[model samples]
Target: MSTDSTSLKLKKEIEEAADFLPLLGTDYIELYVGNAKQSALYYQAAWGFQPLAFSGLETGNKQSASYVLVQDKIRLVLTSPLKEGGPINRHIDKHGDGVKVVALWVDDARKSYQETVKRGARSYMEPKSIEDENGEVVLSGIHTYGETVHVFVERKNYHGAFMPGFKPWNPAYQPEGTGLKYIDHMVGNVGWNEMGKWCEFYAHVMGFAQLVSFDDKDISTDYTALMSKVMSNGNGRIKFPINEPAEGKKKSQIEEYIEFYNGAGVQHVALATDNIIETVKKLQQRGVEFLKVPSTYYDTVLDRVGQIDEDLEPLKELGILIDRDDEGYLLQLFTKPVLDRPTMFFEIIQRKGAKSFGKGNFKALFEAIEREQKLRGTL
Candidate 1:
């Protein structure tokens, strides 16, 4: 077959899949960390996440401590084991403050679990209900790539601070939000040649369709290369772009992640903001470090992305990257690794009608990452 015809056929087949287990939106992302209290404080002070709820010994029957933080529609749960030698502790030891749960808000947890489990998903948690004076919530989970799991949270009947066993955390140190709205998407880095396997899992088990795909030629620097595929559910509320290392002269970022993380894991969480310039200013003032591309990057950026709404001066000053797709353009910046290991980070993004990831900026972005890896002696 001719290459052009083959491309058209593949594009035609990449339509949205059927929605079996409807997902409302992201419920909360829970991270297994070493110290939930200190981490909570860090997020509050640095990222402007307000303390929303707390679960620990005070809540009674506690094996672990959890601090829930919220900013707009985004909710983050930081958890730490109160005692040693448990699964949480083991996860911490293995991954070192990485994401463990990507919870999806659903209307019926039982049906969600059953649909996925019957479709060949490995069960992580059986559907169970937890209740308090406020209401009741049903939660079910299934294992995904690495130690990470997707939890189906049915909270239509709950209305308390968070859920059962967590009280409202009204601390005096609530910082003003930085205009971060909600999770735009999350990226996962897998081992070599495993991206397609996990993409298939999302396709068959969760009813997600492949939105886009990138090869090594599309996302590569002078020394590193990787392949990626973007997957999205029926409603397009949740998007996951799975990445795997490709052959290159030096180590790619995916290789470095798997080496330090010891397995496949969540690479970064991209948070959406309405105002990129102001939000980046607040985050920088609050001491969140971001990757820097050369000033030369801005010299010809506009020539590539064409006219944008924001002034170029502040965006260049703040070191934010800009990319344009067929739909529209997006402004985004990547933070350095938030934890000790260079595993997980955050991507602050502002999409101005763009429905695609930043494919136009992949070369410059990967070059910046290669510089960081050189400093860490990992590349």
Candidate 2:
């Protein structure tokens, strides 16, 4: 009867017909940084990420060092170049420490790479096997946008601490997790007018399907504008929303990211949590700064989004936003730039049942972002 209900019905139909990619979920996300040890501490102290494993000169890798952190199903590998003039150094010099690899768990890494490469994807890594005492892992990759890569990881046979070269790292101090479950989605900011091409790459090459599309009118405020298309696999475990800057009165956030990140790169990581209030409290206590909306935005938010179960005060107190679709509602919040370069940040999200992203909170969310941009003198 309602628009939301009809949309939900169509969504189910689309899922039924979507192609299965024989993929599990995100295995891990690897980031290139200037200092792996320092960044690992930052994640531990700020985001309650437990030190899971590590690899470096300690593990006989002389070129680079990597620290693996885990919070529930989400894993982050922070890496840094140990030498100059290497690819890692070049990546950091150009992009200043952003997401480099989005590793996906799959049943067959070789088959996955073959399917995508045959569909016109550029090869980044040919399928290779690495074995250790635990077992062996098959890894393959293909270039996505910019220098970003999608790594298909077949670890069903491996049970080591992590991959092949890493050793288990259990430190004396570890931050308690903030109820973060896993990655909900990873958002990318492409160069001008590149969103459509990348979205097609996901659809045709990776066997993903377009879930939703947002134009500038829907995602912009008065000063900045961007267009985005959400793409997901058949089972809906992996989601990637590609964004491209649209013409606006001023430079859009996507454009700013592309400029500072030196071409296209990951914009933000959306991590799913179960309890918003508790997770926000824990993150805030650990010194994580979040974007804030005007308190006035919450005065009528409930009236607009319809009946919601969460008390408005906790949300307003923590700067969390809420939206309701046909299936249910979701609570979400955005973090300030994790780095000084204003390139990459994170999102903590909790979806009760709503399949849609927070379309209702776009204006308020962008306004909050614009305020941050203004402070940084980017807008």
Candidate 3:
């Protein structure tokens, strides 16, 4: 087969795997920020991410700022600029607040690095070691997007809950956690004509394969549309869905993201919890505000989608939305813009049995976003 034909065939097989995405779980999500402390507080108080580790003035790593937060199975590292001129600062100035690293957990960092590089991947960093009382940790990285990277983490040598220096936070003000267990999927919005390029990068460079695809025709509305392709590793644990907006009567959400972000970058990080109602409630009390959906949405949810295993009352109370597909049902909710710029956000999701992105709810969810855009004068 021709090279392009071979790739297309491989992509088709990958997407059809469905529940077989082989990802172990999320290692850590690193965000480049202007202020690590403030962002840390925002996550802890609003999102219920607990203080898991710290490194900075207090820890003697003063070159840059860092904070580590954790939930049941998720770890988030917040890094910021300590100097006026630095790469982190440049990224923030260009792209606003967004994910810089989507680290993956592995048994052997060195091998993962060697294998991917041998497969035509461009190296971002060589495998290196960080030591502490728990043990040693090895890590490596590969470039993904404009200023975005995927890091390989080998923690077999460590025994701590998170990386070293992060003490178990017993903060009195910590927000209670929602049942979010791990990262379900992370979606990125790229510039026009960039989706296929990135998808190819994942396929040839990182050994990932495209799993599912949606063109503007599938995802677009009369006013707006975008194309997307989901790529995943052999183990479905890690999924990266790339998107690019198509011309529309009004600005689509992908277009808005590219505009505010100033280039191609992550649009949202969808974190998966086990119990969304508990998670969202804790998130709300802690200060995280979700995109407002009317209470009336719950009125016809059951009638429209049929019965789910979860109680409808609590879901309605928390403004969590549900949808179904031939595969199964999934519940999810979105947070309002999480950064100063209207760029990046978070999604709290609970997957009962469904493996698909909430396609059934995209219309409702996008309309909810449109409401927010109208208020911000961006619609």
Candidate 4:
């Protein structure tokens, strides 16, 4: 099939998928960490996240402490258990510091929950309204792959710093942002052959469409391989690329992640930046480390992706990868795992009219990842 025809077909499918539920965008991503206070400090200093809200002992919540941080459209809630013997503690013990909830902003939380539940989604939380002096916010949730969840948030009637249980947090230490605009996409690493199952769940339960698919042939390095499918909603506001390990000479990154994370879970969050060069420079200055691909990879990148707006020297110097589709091209870089376990990481991406994931760069990207796995002695 021609590139134009393929793009058109994918666009039509995406448009058709939007009729199920009305999702505005990603509201916030909540991570259950071991220490909310120290993690908040690390995010504020290293990732340029500004303190937004807090919910804990002072707020009369004796169970757990939650810290909310915001950078542009991205809001991160880092929560830690105040008391022992709870789900939060168990999650921390099992998965370490990883994403527990992916909240979506919607028009009506109740209707969203009803439609999805009626479509076979397991109910995680029924629609519940919480109010404060600001107003009222309704929230509902459903379980997704692994223990990860999708929470529907209806906040049009609220005007608070965050939600009802949280108060505004203004600390003396404030930092500048890294030009990350919003979440581009999030990738999930499922178990051996669970990618197709979760893909069906998203398609039938949540009304998402498969935008693209990659076999082991497309994503394989010499030592490792994996299969993935990209699922997107109608408005294209949310995208999830689900991956599972494929048979290979050595352990693939997907297998390594599932083994360390103890099960299927989120692998990485891709953050979008308008100016990736500037944003990556600032992140590097703040002690962020990205995977290093061989410099030879850049020698033929422009030849494949064609001409781009930014110069190649800076991108190559900073170890960013480039790929092109029918629409345009994209620049992306992956960081090493931010936690002690080689589980979750971050992807910094800048889309230059490209709607597709970085298919053309998968081999090089996976080769770089394999190098990291080798260093950790996991491959």
Candidate 5:
């Protein structure tokens, strides 16, 4: 297995673009960090994600660290550079640790790469074929905002559960998964006047259609501001919201991420689960701390939102919150920043046939975050 840059070959754009629609779901999310072992353990224990595969010192990966973790349908690979002065280390030092790869499962890798490239995408990784007895798998990558990337995965020919050389991690340990079945959404934070550039990239290069748009007025506090536009595939299985900080009294969260990360990058990943109450219960028991809203917010929740399916008792019991709009309703809770810096968080979300993002919950969620900021002295 040659891991040389020369082995990477960029595919030319196809004359007729590949039908890049109807994304099945997220294949895997890769995060570049400072420590993959500890981060893998945290996901396995706290997030109820089990170890699916791993690669490191024993596997002849002498220059880096990596681990693949799974929870039901969701798969995440954490990778950190072993030595300093590399691209991965620079990403961690600047971004304070965040997602680096959003791998999308496709039928054809070369065609997918060609289709997106023809639409004017800047290439990150050229289409490369990795194979073993299980068969061959082709992969390609394109640049997105910040240091983030979208990897196109063509696995129809590969029969292996994951990539080659990874043993099925079956430990005596099994924690109740946090109802997160698949990735519901992944948000990106871009720099000022950069949202449109990235949005246009997705729209033209990847054939993504705009799902929704929100301005600083849509999601803001008196002290901070942000503008967002959500892009999704035709079938809507994949959703990405691009955000840029707007002028505010103080530095906005988007601004903070861009400043510390030294550029644009992913902000948070919202994982989907069928049963949020059970998921939250298990996560809480395992040391995953979520942001908490004041009790008073719940007092007027029912009156403002009217009737819903779930009983209010269970929601309050698990500290889960609900918000509704004319379109539909969504249940979401945010994890406190997990990394050392005040950046990179997770959103445990369950959508009950809702298509819209949880806009109604912004006020309560921001206030909870503000409370944390106050304690950290960042506010």
Candidate 6:
């Protein structure tokens, strides 16, 4: 791939993206961390998530313990190793408390597995049935770009708070929701040359279509460069951006993540909000740090993006970024690294009518990231 080329690889874009697996929305995101207890508490206190459920030795199930946190329709399952040499611990050592499963809510887990496997997705697991007094739910799995896996969850027949075995988690203190609605999208950082290979896999196996593509020309800055292509399933509910580093004058953010994370993994999770101003304000008050762009960025951004409904003052006050496409505009802000490794973070996005990622903000975003990398001595 030429770093200077602005042309799209037409062959790689799915002409008529398939719909073999009808997905509803994100069922939940499961992370393999070193400590689930503390992580759960951090989420509830910092992000305003509520304790929803728990699963562990109390149920005599597996060697790991998992705490499920909830806010609105969003669910996060944090799993930790109970002993030294277990699968969860291995993941923690390798990826350092990162996302493992991006589970999708589906209509049929059995058919979801069969159709995807037949279409060339690497089979992570066949459909399995799990039942409790509440009801029965089926699950299936398949591998995506790297070690990350996608689990198909069929819960039409289940009525428990979460999956079976996870009792209600009634912690002594529960925090209120922070106005976060659900997952807007998930972005992944891949190896230097593997972005298109997995994009094609999603087009075929997972029945996704190319929503948009940003070559080096669209996002390249003088010191940094990378290419991104967004993929979305039918109904436009799920979106994934696959990113790979491109040749540049300095180290790209995607390269830095792959280095410290030990391999390709989820770079960040974008959370949707109806009001980003209030949500980010509360988050900052609760100790969430965000990336700071130059004061000049807000000066001329309005000229480029045209007038928006949001007052320019608060957007600047909150360090929020703005972008516009043919459809409409969106307001987004980035949080600093959620863990010590600088691997995973969060994106707070509020879309008015825009159906695209913030292409216009890429240069500033990369520059902000580069500043952080220099401080860490990684650039």
Each prediction's TM-score against the native?
Answer: 0.96, 0.95, 0.88, 0.96, 0.91, 0.95
User: lDDT of each prediction vs. the true structure?
Assistant: 0.91, 0.88, 0.78, 0.91, 0.79, 0.88
Off by over 4 Å in 3: 1-23, 164-175, 294-300
Tell me the spans in candidate 1 whose CA falls farther than 4 Å from its real position: 1-15
* Model 5 agreement with the true structure over 1-379: per-residue lDDT tens digits: 1122322232312223222632455789999988888888888888878777777777677788788888877899999888878888877777767888999877666887888888787899899998778777788888887678889887767777677655456666766666678888899888899999988887778877787899878788878778999987765667899998888887777777676677887789998888888888888888888998887777988897788888888788766878777667778888988887777889988887677788877777776777787787766
Q: What is the C-alpha lDDT profile of model 6 across 1-379, one tens digit per residue?
A: 0011121112332346676677777899999988899999899988999998899999876688999998987899999988889777888888899999999988788999999999888898789998888888889999987689999988888888788888888979898778999999999999988999989888888889989899999888888899999998876778899999999998888888999898989999999999999999999999999998998998899899998998999989999999999989999999989999989999999999998899999989888988998999888
Tell me how candidate 4 scores on lDDT. Answer: 0.91
Candidate 1 backbone collisions, by pair: none
The candidate, 1 or 3, that scores higher on lDDT is 1
RMSD of each: 6.8, 5.6, 6.2, 5.3, 5.7, 6.9
List, residue by residue over 106-187, the lDDT tens digit for candidate 3: 6667877887788677899999988778777788888877778888887766777566655444556676666667888899
Better of 3 and 6 by TM-score: 6
lDDT of 4 by residue, 1-379 (tens): 0011122222333665744776777999999999999999999998999999999999999999999999999999999999989999999999999999999988788999999999999999999999988888899999999999999988878888998999999999999998989999999999988999999998998888889999989989888999999998887888999999999999999999999999999999999999999999999999989999999998898889999998999999999999888998999999999999999999999999898889988888888888889899999
User: For candidate 1, lDDT tens digit of each residue in 1-379?
Assistant: 0011122122222357766777767889999999999999999999999999999999894699999999999999999998879899999898899999999988789999999999999999999999998889899999999999999988877889899989999989989999999999999999988998999999999999999999999999889999999998877888999999999999999999999999999999999999989998999999999999999999999999999998999999999999999889999999999988989999999999888899988999999999999999999
> Residue 371 error for model 4, in Å?
0.9
Candidate order (TM-score) = 4, 1, 2, 6, 5, 3
Better of 2 and 3 by lDDT: 2
Candidate 6 residue runs with Cα over 4 Å from true position: 1-15
Model 4 poorest ten-residue lDDT run: 1-10
